[model samples]
Target chain A: MTATLLEPTADPVAAVRRARRGPRRRYLAVLGGLIVLATAAFAVNVLLGDYTYTVPDFFRILFGEQLPVATYLLMESKLPRAVLGILVGLCFGIGGAVFQTTLRNPLASPDVVGVTWGASTAAVVAVITFGLRGTAVSLAAIGGAVAVALLIRSVGGNVGSHRIVLVGVAMTAALASFIEYLLSRASIWDVQVALQWLAGSLHASDWPTVRAVALSAAILLPLLAVLSRSLRVTQLGDDLATGLGARRFAPDGMLLIAVLLVAVAVAASGPIAFVAFMAGPTARALNGGRPTLLGAGLVGVVLVLSADFVGHYLIGDITVPVGVLTGACGAPFMLWLLARGTSSRSSS
Target chain B: MSVSTSARLVAADVTIGYGERVVVEALDLAVPDGAVTVIVGANACGKSTLLRGMARLLRPQSGAVLLDGVAVHTRSTRDVARTLGLLPQQPITPEGITVVDLVGRGRHPHQGLLGRWTSADERAVTDALVVTGTLDLADRAVDELSGGQRQRVWIAMALAQDTDLLLLDEPTTYLDVAHQVEMLDLLADLNRNRGTTIVMVLHELNLAARYADHLVAMKAGRVVAEGAPHTVVTEEIVRDVFGLDNRVITDPVSGTPLVLPAGRHHRPSLLAGKSPTPEYEGAEYL
Candidate 1:
């Protein structure tokens, strides 16, 4: 290595490119593997129920040829459920990663930082108190998330990233109580629907839910693509980022996009717990510990779809909500991460 | 050098501060083109703040920092970035980032939003690594490098920006004496060979005097003295700027002014019979 460095390469450009190729190939390989896994998980979620269908059968139904008993079930329930899973997963994954990167903290995922809670609180209030349904609940969720984001920003006072995160945690606590109060007053029939908001479920997945999430993805993905270039600069901290000619408002733009993504995902999937929190860190770990938003989004699809499938088919007789399964696992992992972070910091 | 005739960066009565606490008040400086200028001051004397104002990191309240007769703040950030580069006092090193990737980010201003990693970008990055003598460590993670090496890698990153003008804040802050001299020497080489206009905030007065073609001494947010090291490093200005009672003598190695502080206890009389007559034995303090 020393000899190579001492004797300058004939073409420095080629040498640099050769040096970079290893990591680039590894990153691309990880992304490709994730895409394949997500597709398989989507297929499993859609096709591998009590009544199984082959790939050709699924594709045939997709092209509008009806099978005997499979057509109705696949079209109405399984297909929409799988599609909504992919959409929400993509949204939460990208949103959570963006939030984490922007705040420069692993603990700053949307679900952990009160964004999902905001959506849930508004959604519960809309369902129980206002007797709202369908699209109304989604709108309330989006409004609630945006309102909470603004509140956190105002209360945090622009001092530090941790201040905003602390304010968000406090808001999450306060909003949790408000949600509980609304739930206590809800009628039994209303509570059944409100439970979807409290503990997230894909059981309520329908064509409308899928369409609403798809619409959001259509708007947000383009914005994310444009804004992601700034992420590379912003990760270097404000002083250097500004010196490197990054737009002053780039971080704010990223945060806004992340908020909208989380809000829309929660509106569709009822704030499926920890999908937003888990996906980014997982994808980053897979990418050799460098953050990748696209990888995170793809991982989110796999996580939610696989978890939903496990809850429905892999478990025994009783079906579990996807939220409960994720929350069961995610809460402990978050504690572990926090503990590790504190210990490492103190030791260092 | 004629300051008015050849100055590329001129701070015209810039009063800059954070919030209402004004740190630098009505400070004017013309950084001579194609020369190394070092700003030296005691703590909270606004040398770093002055550099920030010139680098466009802070806005002057009433006056302007002009580059090529145009206000820097009024120009697009990319346009200013192409002409100038700044290495902040403490720049963050991203986790697990290689030296090459970190240096390559310096090409940001030259690239469009959707710009590909062109061969020119590759060459610039490679050139930066070579210039900083860090090509061997190009594939290494930044955090794993030693303090001196990490700092050189950061300089390489700044160099990759390929700006004619470079500003550094406390570039030798945490390094040992040997590394500090090494860092300043590398910068001097850049100025001499590439004619890159260099301005920096340096804590070590001796090193500053050695490396700076133009030396500035500041006190209480204003310029106390600025000229060649021989002219600027008089005992009177040292006392004025740093509140140190010191004797200025010629540096034996570099032939620049060197300050030797004299406390109430350590007097010049102690060295009377120990060494030959000092260079400034009978010279006036000024």
Candidate 2:
């Protein structure tokens, strides 16, 4: 009988427990460590600014003790900025990983494929041409992302990841030209505002912006979590995934969720560059490449918060926004990754 | 951990293809339960397509593949997955995935919605590694492995599924001679010891003849000759199916058929090196 043929393993059933528990425990520990680091960075961003509000000041401000300059600076502006940064990072990190893992291409993230540029072009058009302001701009951005994503899908011809990247590259180029053309046509004051938004800043952080991102997260994160298990299996080649009972529709569904996440993220933070692209591979390395969405998200939070803090405080005189800093840091990293050419090498 | 079901699979009146190009048409075949069935054919001959259809990786345009008298496509895929496992040719191994983790993915069908990796999943993975002699490589990354080791690791993953029926497509394409034998031997052990019904597409005629309990030789999208390998593998069938002249000899060791293509040379004797035709010797020399 097959039962008799199953050799008695040298280690008792205990080996199985270790095999399952060991890497997961280590991954969770690393994720917890990253979270703690992000939280510490966030606290410093809130409390260690020029005015230097302490823990007591934060607590008192929370209790409605309006301590003039400290309350306005710390509780009102910095607090919302830091919270919004974390949510935006989570969206980028998880969304990027979802796209990369499902498509099985490291360069398939929304950033690489012009999804962010699509949103920016739409938002810029709304501001300059339509003369739109407030929530309409955000809606325009989301709509842009979805529309561009659909365009990429159509133009890329369902061939593979490389095709999507090529189409995305073309889209990014075309949109950049259009954005520049729009910028040249705008008034001086509008140009400054558009420039700042294009660079991706958290300068005008208020509860409403924070609340919008939070509400979106509240709805989307749980939906993503429910689908995450199926996402893991879909990472295997499609034939094997379907062979294991994953629905034939799983990849398309995951792609939709990824697009939605990207759209929400762009609407909130104006397409923070490379957070989505880098988060997946970074988290993959941190956990020894098993593909953990949570790990990617935590890394995203850390990257964004640290970049923001550095942008605000590290430089003197002129304040550089977080996206500029991330772009400055990320461009070199992307070049190095490109030079390494390992992304194309990770084949199925 | 317990799956007790009939490993009976049948493809009835099946017509399958990719878009407009038809691969196999009007084919009816039943897999012998608890036995090894090898489908052999020349290039682009639809052997792999048939295997894929039977494994439910492809749907027939006209007919259905039935498992235990119920249509496989109509049945719950989760249930079918638990009943059957497949190791695709050259499966993709994600970058930097550990051997143990890769094999544990086989437990996907057994997993719940949350996919809590159970102790049983672990045991199955470990048992599979041990069976395939890759237990020592459990911690190594798959990309770092040699091709043969990677193939064995993939087999371990399939074995971890612990299905009653397993289908493999060209499972030995990448292995060297010794390793190919070793891999076939391992499959044979699984068939003998566990009674797992295996359906595979193999290109090597000699190995197919030696190992298959049921050998199906295909030509132009139809089974040309099929039976026990000893009966089906012959000069006439080889010439008909493969468009080649061949002599079948008994493998001295296994007592199964061995195919040697009849070509420009044969065993030499005292007076044997001339062309057999009269037109080539007397008239042409004159």
Candidate 3:
């Protein structure tokens, strides 16, 4: 028995080293595959269209070569929408992963945590109540999201898996009702504008919206990546995390940044339902239960771009809003999640 | 790494509790350096509360917990964490976290914001896993492990902290009898080999008597008796602290006092006719 125990001691570090090596290789391979797939899909979306631009022609237009009106369609319209779709997807994915992991609850997404609701409520209020437009709406949306986050954190009492989710759900319901009341009292034209926002769309994507999303992503995504390791520790619960020398404030601060990222995404293209909710869990399921922020972001990009493409082209002249499609898809998904949660609780 | 042998912990009239109710009063206690001190008491007896107070996880309401004559709360959290490690009961492990990753977190005190994983961190993690005999399971997810294996993983996480002072709260909660003895033996080895100061709250009076170098018995948020196990464990103290009818006997292996309760079967034949002994051993065991 002593000799057998001694054998394990000799090769103790080898197992951990090998385990670390395997995960790194697997993570890299998954990331590479997703990048290739996203790039191909992006190329296809850019090149193949109703305006009849070939792949080579699309490339030529991208390289600043003069071509037909089809080239203009490729350069001006589809490119910006596709780019915005990917950027918005990335923000949704990373933001969702951060919120879910930090709260230690699968149901804790930006939508469920009141960040999306906060942004939407602000945008709706801006358009209907204040008659605000353009950049002012976005600024109001950001302020609204930050205020809601701080308020919920302050008044939500204790921090726990169940308490955060319950408080977030309550806040979301309250905000949604407030927005509805504002819509009920608005003038017809203002109500129409608010209604369009309520059904989130990338219909208004131009150089400016794309620029806003790019700028937001550039600032937020790298900051999130830098804080990822600390966030991982935080998921282990506060006492253990603190015992391990993780600061109490850093993880909470990173979560606020994540909320800001989601708010920006919502500001760019209204609160697209379930993209933020579905991305993280979908990525985790695909990656075999390891929480992959980057991979989830990639998945979010794929989800939003594909949904937007289908919504745009599948129904021809109708021009259905992408948010409508997502809500249509997401409502059932949320119900299914609720059903699963109830069943799991009963069984457990 | 070897710790200084004479590292003493002094609590000068320390009072600790939550908001209004003071659990531990203005009581002075000294834990000798490089000794295994086991705290035993009933539930809500402030054994775990005192351990938390000493670890600076709880602030004292009145006095101070001092390490080497310095107030523990005055030091930075990182400084305190580096020297004093605590294993809390019922800590939640993040889903799908591997043992190596969890153990690696124990090195956080030694690492800075700019510092990535170093050779020292790697060595500490590896050493911890090895010492706890959990190296083979390092790649396994924590949730997938057995109860005994999971407890060892938690101990490995604490060991990876590389602190000279370790405090544990009910470390053998869910373990079987065999595993409980094994854990206490491992802790005893750690204390003896490294000269590490170990303070633990144990519910089992017999186990505490068998394992501890120094034993503290508490009742209703007060220290009733404290000394070497042989000197502290007595029938009168056991009856008063736990309110159980138990006889004190010498443990053959450890040569320490062991409390064997006189249940229904063990009651004398003469007393059986006059008044029947309680059939169930009381709620104290439960």
lDDT leader: 1
Residue pairs with backbone overlap in model 1: none
lDDT for residue A208 in candidate 2, whole number 0-100:
89
True contacts kept of each: 0.39, 0.45, 0.34
lDDT of 1 by residue, B1-286 (tens): 3333489999999999889898899999999999999999999999999999999989999799999999999999988999999999988777667788888889988888875788788888988887778877777878788999999989988999999999999999889998898788888878877889999999999999999889999988899999988899999999989999899999999899999998644567756645543555444354
* Runs in model 1 lying further than 4 Å from the true structure: A1-11, A339-348, B1-4, B269-286
True contacts kept of 2: 0.45
**Model 2: per-residue lDDT, tens digit, B1-286?**
1222334898899999999998998888888888898999888889999999988989999899999899999998888999889888757777767778888888888998778878788778877877787776777778888888888888888898889999999999978998898888888889888888988999999999889988899877778877799888988888888888777889998899998876433323312866544344345345
* lDDT by residue (tens digit), candidate 3, A1-348: 111123464565677687566656777888887788778767766666576567777777889997767667766788998898888889888898888777767688878879788888888988987899889998888888888887777776544547777888899999989988998899998988787656778777788889988998899877776667676556666666666666657767778888888888888888888888888877775665677899889988887887787788787777778878877888777776677556532100
lDDT of 1 by residue, A76-146 (tens): 99999999999988998899998888888888888887988999999999999999998889899999999
Alpha-carbon runs more than 4 Å astray in model 2: A1-9, A157-160, A339-348, B1-7, B265-271, B274-286
Worst-scoring 10-residue span by lDDT in model 3 chain A: A1-10
Model 3: how far residue A342 lies from native, Å: 8.1
- Expressed as tens digits, the lDDT of each residue in A105-167 for candidate 2 is 778888888888888888988888888877898899899988998899888865235788889
Interface RMSD of each: 4.6, 3.9, 4.3
Question: Could you give candidate 3's per-residue lDDT for residues B1-286 as a string of tens digits?
Answer: 2323454687789899889999998867787678888999888889888888887778899999998789988877777788888888878776567788878888878887754888888889888888888888878878788888889888988998999889898999989999999888888878887777999999999999988888899887778998888788999999899888888888887788988887655666636566663556673366
